[model samples]
Target: MINKIVQNMAEAMAGVKDGMTVLLGGFGLVGQPNNLVDALIETGVKDLTVVANNAGGGTTGLTALMEHGRVRKLVCSFPRSNNTIFEELYRAGKIELEIVPQGTMAERIRAAGAGVGAFFTPTGVGTKMAEGKEVREFNGRKMVMEYALPGDIALVEAWEADRWGNLTFKLSGRNFNPVMATAAKTTIVQTQHIVELGALDPQHIMCPGLYVDRVIHIPYGDPPF
Candidate 1:
């Protein structure tokens, strides 16, 4: 098995360039790849289009990337929160928005991972989400066309991972990390603990090593409240 461990976040995130689309895994900051996000901020790359569940708040994680003016567009389900980082940017016209239904967002990324180019859904039909999109009838129900959300790179967070990149997520923190893993060309994981090969129980592994490209171990504690 190939050992996918990288020395640090920088090494794991190498080759991230300007104007590239990146998928960041997390529901808020719960499962965010903080270390890797910090690396992106430090890289000073601009014109990034970020795809995530929500735009981050405060000055960390997804919000940090937006705060630094690195983000050119945001594709998310819930773009608002107490932080207002995303809102501030959007209001100023500094970034563009593609609001998608939460379930549709998940499905789109999952479809991309599953090698599906596009799919039809009734979730957004007759609503603004369906506007300008190709509409078709399925079982006599109107459905809207939505494309897959394949990304150039994926920043994922895992609770634990083996040397081979088999990952286990903790509780709700697992949220989009697994799906985002497959939807991106390069999947880089920030793991809380790195175990020896074969240490992770197969049943507990939410994501197999095949979907992961690199693993960076960062010992972190609970999410900031």
Candidate 2:
């Protein structure tokens, strides 16, 4: 029997190591795997390069990770929030930042999962984001080439999961979880509910079991950091 469920947070995060590029799923705080993020912080791994939609806010999840100085760089669309963790680290020269356009960032992650070598888009054409990148013309419009974004590990949160690792998200929580699941070497999920193998409805499963490597049940509520 193939079971992807793990009994504890440590087992779920066993493969994470220092200096790895980690993809974090969430739009702000909605879809983040707070449990896994907290575990990663506890592991004390350093020099991580994180890819996410926005730099985290408040003193939990991604923001807490940044505050601990575990991350070396961040590849994200937006870095500013009500919290000053990212800004403090950035101004103090403790971290590196790569600003990618929101649409391009999503496409890059999707491209990695689809096995695409590269893609061209007009989102950042003629801007500093396009600097040093190969540009081509299609129908007289300039497009900048962006490569796929892959991660060593991806931490995601799902509303529900089964023993097989199939996942379902609630409303806006589905944001980047599905794509991040596919674009990482090891995708570890923190699900609120872990059901029996056949419990998940096939039509509603957003992320298939094939893409998930580990799942740990975390239930509902904010996990301590």
> Once model 1 is optimally superposed onto the true structure by TM-score, how far is the C-alpha of residue 13 displaced, in angstroms?
1.4
lDDT by residue (tens digit), candidate 2, 6-66: 9988898897899999999988668878779899999999999999988886678899999
* Candidate 1 Cα misplacement greater than 4 A, ranges: none
The CA root-mean-square deviation of candidate 1, after full C-alpha superposition on the true structure, stands at: 1.1
- Any residue pairs clashing in model 2, and if so which? none
lDDT of each: 0.90, 0.91
- Candidate 1 lDDT trough over 10 residues, lowest sum: 54-63
Indicate the TM-score of model 1: 0.97
For model 1, how does the per-residue alpha-carbon lDDT over 26-124 read when each residue is reduced to its tens digit? 986688888899998998989999999887855788888888899999999999876888887899999999899999999999999999999999998
**Model 2, poorest ten-residue lDDT window?**
216-225
Query: TM-score for each prediction?
Result: 0.97, 0.96
lDDT of 1 at 189: 96
Residue 217, candidate 2: C-alpha displacement in angstroms: 0.4
